[model samples]
Target: MSSLKPILLVEDNPRDLELTLAALEKCQLANDVIVARDGEEALSLLTHRDPGSGEFTLVPAVVLLDLKLPKVDGLEVLERMKGDPETRHVPIVMLTASREESDLVRSYQHGVNAFVVKPVNFRDFFQAIRDLGVFWAILNEPPVTTRRPPASTYAKGV
Candidate 1:
């Protein structure tokens, strides 16, 4: 059931990023991970044009977001994703260091599918990433979309 779709990691801290990537590497899911250094970059990579390419391509899969980010914050990214019709169905899991009650409440309210607080211990962090990878990549059922082919495919005479 592993779709091989890329996992989007939206994190700002270098240490956390390294740890999470390492944990993800240990997991059964060896799927390619796309990393965005900040919330703005994360949003662009996930929902908008690729900064280097400027193409409207669909990179299907879920987003693992961190709350505290530079530029556009995680909450803002979540809001934009949930607000848009095209991106709303994409599952967004919040993986952040913040344990504030308000952060949790706002995340869920903004339609985050899952919320995980960063574990202080290395073992716990690894376990959390592994579990997250297993569940989202294998267990979860994403929405299905049906669409007509592009105009180029249609007969010009008709």
Candidate 2:
């Protein structure tokens, strides 16, 4: 099996999801692209500790998160992931169609690695996703995380 880590894509819109997937495919990235239709699903894929107890655990190479989502919002998801030691080191890029400045500010405040406004035109959006896929998946080298201690340990500053 390939050691390449998968990419978590959290998008609720069907068309947008399809387009993003296609763009990533065009990028020809070897890493798998996992889909999470909502914030809840994204959180489950990222967090879900205790493998023996049957909790889901997936630390993706990166997370492309949308701002507006069903159930839980992206900012909350970012906050939770950044707040947790298990997933904080994982990079997250906010990919959204929202032009609101507040959204951008809040995303940065929540520790998002990058914030990208989804382009309106088809070709632009496609190229944007392709560039993002190539950069984050193929070009960017992530930090090696060999140790995964319990969250409680970090709470005690150990």
Candidate 3:
């Protein structure tokens, strides 16, 4: 399926980022992938509003976040996003190499939608990312919101 929304990838490691991107590309998912090298950059992108439209620019179908990052950790980013009304509905997946139990617990506590442990082997990593891409970008169904007319407008029309 063709996805209009982009996928947000917040990764700090260059090699991992390269590998992840390559894996996603191999999957041939139609959605565009936006990369942020740091937590600050990710937050900036997530919160940035367009001057003309007054709407946020970084609405993604899914967010693949690394646990460890510079300037602000992934947990902090996840917390901020979950706390914000506008961003709370966006699905966030913690994609990290860390296997600490505390990190997993903390991520779920902070309201991460999914958690994926990065595989050490190149082939395993590639397969894992491809599966993630296919599932999130293709199979997952997100909540749909419908716009309603204001009371004043409805009364006037009536």
Candidate 4:
């Protein structure tokens, strides 16, 4: 596992954040987890640029996003990310407590890779998080990006 790739967690609720962190820790996932308190912060982190080099920072392996958030909601965030070519490839999982069918439909429409309802029971929540961490961080294969040849190269046909 590449330690450079972090897991982006966008959750506003402190208790939920703590519980999620604990669950991930208990599962012993080696990847680092970066927390974003709200949707705005999550977007900032994902699109952050270095002042000196003007280069983007770490790209997360996966994003665990909550539905209800401050500044911007999860669905909006998902929409923005999916719309942008730079961030569109990053897998986003809707990890929320909402059971609304509309939210689920909208999430999938906005290109959310997965949607997981937060379990109320402690044991169930822990197990769910653990499974999610294992699958996304260790098992899932991200899409491969192929660079398009330059127009000149194609023009030459050599």
Best model number under TM-score: 3
lDDT of candidate 2 vs native?
Answer: 0.84
Q: Tell me the whole-model lDDT of each prediction, alpha carbons only.
A: 0.77, 0.84, 0.84, 0.83
* Model 4, span 23-91: residue lDDT tens: 988988877788888999889887876566555564777899999999999999999999999889989
Judge candidate 2 at residue 84 and give its lDDT: 89
TM-scores of the models, in the order given = 0.83, 0.88, 0.89, 0.87
lDDT tens string, model 1, 1-158? 23356678888899998888888778857456778888888776665544455533445467899999999999999999999887788889999989999999999999999999989898999899989987887788877754212222221110
Off by over 4 Å in 4: 145-158
lDDT of 2 by residue, 1-158 (tens): 23567788999999999999999988888777889999998897677666564433466778999999999999999999999887899999999999999999999998999999999999999999999998898889988896443322111000
- What's the TM for model 3? 0.89
Give one digit per residue, the lDDT tens place, for model 3 in 1-158.
23357788999899999999999999998777889888998898888766665667557778999999999999999999999988899899999989999999999999999999999999999999999888888899988733221222111000
Error of 4 at 65 (Å): 0.2
The residue ranges of model 2 lying beyond 4 angstroms of the native Cα positions read 53-56, 147-158
Error of 3 at 100 (Å): 0.7
| Alpha-carbon deviation at 142 in model 2, angstroms | 1.0
Candidate 3 worst ten-residue window by lDDT: 149-158
Model 1, residue 96: C-alpha shift (Å): 0.8
Give the clash count for model 1: 0
